[model samples]
Target: MAGLVAALIVGVGLWWSSPVSSGDVHRYVTEAARQQQIALNDGSLVELNVSSDLSVKPTAGERRVTLAAGEAHFAVAHAMARPFIVTAAGVSVLAVGTAFSVRLGETGVEVLVTEGRVEVARDPVDAATSGGGRPKLGVGERTLFYATNP
Candidate 1:
């Protein structure tokens, strides 16, 4: 019993001290009442709206995020090699160095582009394999994808 307790304490210490790991463990940013801002490892900035939930997964080649609820604004760093992607509902919004906002509503997911351009696709895997050419949205453009649409 003493040995087990010591091992558990060591495990907790390791988990607390390690900020970056080899595995692609997702980091989360959740807001309940007020807006929250977070700076990502790749120089991207995220502004989470009230009652929003966002999970970030950074891999060797890509930066990925999932918008679970509410809305958030993303200002991605300019990196052509590493694309930034946000998955909400069944849609994927892909961008490289752009500013955009994603809002999850009761009926559908809405994507608004304020700067640069973004691509919206039904399947992220297909979007990646197909050169991410499903449908592109430019600045001042937006799209809504209903849950029943895809």
Candidate 2:
């Protein structure tokens, strides 16, 4: 039917206009004593510090990054509808149009905000072992999260 065809066309158009239409995974890593900078498809920028590992996956609704090790700085793009979330060592840092850095250490994770604000929360799985409450960090603010069991 013509109605069905029109609806299908609209759906395809919407999908094409999305920030990230496909589930593509991007990985970035740095060697010892070296640093790397990455520019994401969504216009965000990431700086990986020495011996760091990072992965980025932007879905239709959110831009997510995982810090497997070391430290990285994020200069997030302004996407109000899609929040930028960085996860490291059971901690999640959520930001919108902000800049910050996250570091994973042997003891725990550290977050430093240089611009705007970010909300830091512990993953549910690590709640029992995570100490301290959820904190919102603004410019020039920083926090360190330590595992209660560690």
Please report the candidate that would top lDDT against the real structure: 2
* lDDT tens per residue, model 2, 54-150: 8888878788888989999999999987888899988899887999999999889999999999889877312232235557899999999985463
Write model 1 residue lDDT over 1-150, tens digit each, in one string.
999999997886544323333357554444354577778889999988877767788877788888888898999998877889899988889888999999999989999999998889877642246353488899999999988753
> When superposed on Cα atoms, how far off is each prediction in RMSD?
6.7, 12.8
Measured with C-alpha atoms, the lDDT of residue 38 in candidate 1 is: 77
lDDT of 1 at 67: 88
> Which ranges of candidate 2 are over 4 A from the true structure?
1-23, 124-134, 148-150
Evaluate residue 18 in candidate 2 and report its C-alpha lDDT on the 0 to 100 scale.
Answer: 29
Question: Which residue segments of model 1 deviate by more than 4 Å?
Answer: 1-23, 125-127, 130-132
In model 2, the clashing pairs are none
Clash pairs of candidate 1? none
Q: Given candidate 1, what's the lDDT at residue 57?
A: 82
Query: Model 2 reaches what TM-score against the true structure?
Result: 0.76
